[model samples]
Target: MGHRVLAVLLLVAGFVVLAPGTACACSCSDLKPADQMRLSAAVFTGTVVAARQVEGDPAGPTPPIVYTFRPDQVYKGEPVTEVRVASNAESPACGYRFSTGGRYLVFASAEKTGMLQPDPGVPLHTGLCMGNRQVALGTGPVRAGDPVLNGDPISAELVDALGAPKPPSAAPSAPATAPPTAAPASPAASTGGSAPTWIIVAGAVAGAAVVVAAWRLPARRRVRRD
Candidate 1:
């Protein structure tokens, strides 16, 4: 009986050690450029300025990686100079891996909610199979008639589906100069150019009269006591 129990325990330990860990499997539908455009909340071509992995929940799954992008051209949604996009940290989870300097066309969705809610600053999220493809990095804004790069078919497709892209809207123009703050009125100006000259004289005269009356009353009180 002891020999049999020992063998059973050894078999169970071997099974535990040999078992394969579960993995995340991601699936996406084949979507055309037009369909992708319609499904995405924002579409733009940008270069990754920075990338960082956000820490995950200790009790949950791995967190997403965030990439900061400097938009070269905005094809859809509000034109922004800078935006952050989040993706799953693992390739098996369909994360789109972005390099620090690589330029790519991105199809991003709006912010997600719940436990995996993206960073508030990162208002968009993307994935590996979301029709995202790398492009030849270039200088200057994309123009309507500019020549397409040798291997950049994605840009051509985007232009066909979404038309010519626009440069990011200027950084909101410094908040409209705060309306010049109206230059706080001078003290004199605030009080409507001070009291009129006559009013000033009247105040001085009334103050003098009060002083004289008080003096005269004190003298009369002394005389009555005598």
Candidate 2:
């Protein structure tokens, strides 16, 4: 009985020591790409413009890392021109890292702050569990400084799942296809337009010729009869 009790206590102590380490790392069953996209709040392709180290609690270890990205495209969520994201510099805090000048296809969460708040109105962030990572180079041929050279379009039925495909840009590109709209034609100016001076003089000359011709025609007809 004494031996059994000692063994049980030792097991408990061992678990206690190991628990902290397990808890510190980002833990999740590895998911397939489709599943990752399904679970993410937003997914996008961006180029890392900067990685700024941030200080956490003074009592804590080194600060986490914040990454700034210039987004070339958004695969999901409301379209935004650019974004900044934060993650742990180390795996222990579940932080992810971003390399300046590198491009990535990021799976991220949008955390909204009040409009009155300073900084980004809403910021994006991701973690190891979210599957934020680099796109395989073979994804596409990219030109220099292309923000989304990180990745090209992902073919998936799930594309429809990304909130109505950003509702197509409000501005219409091909005017031909747009629905015809009726605009009330402006009524011809109610005021009369002045006739040109040359037109008036020509009309007067035409009237005088008609009168003279009519008078001459009568006289010529009478002379012929006589």
Report the Cα lDDT for candidate 1.
Answer: 0.68
> Model 2 Cα displacement at 61 (Å)?
3.7
Off-target runs (Cα >4 Å) in candidate 2 are: 1-23, 111-122, 136-226
What's each prediction's clash count? 0, 1
TM-score of 1: 0.58
Best by lDDT: 1
Tens digit of per-residue lDDT, candidate 1, span 1-226:
5534432332233222111223456555555677667657788889999998886455545677889999988888888898888887666556678889988778887634322323435767787656777776874544434443333344555568766678887754455444555678766676788966677889999999999999999999999999
Q: Residue-wise lDDT of candidate 2 within 113-138, one digit each (tens)?
A: 11111232235656666666574333
lDDT by candidate, in order shown: 0.68, 0.55
Compare the candidates by TM-score and give the number of the best one: 1
Q: lDDT of candidate 2?
A: 0.55
lDDT, candidate 1, at 207: 100
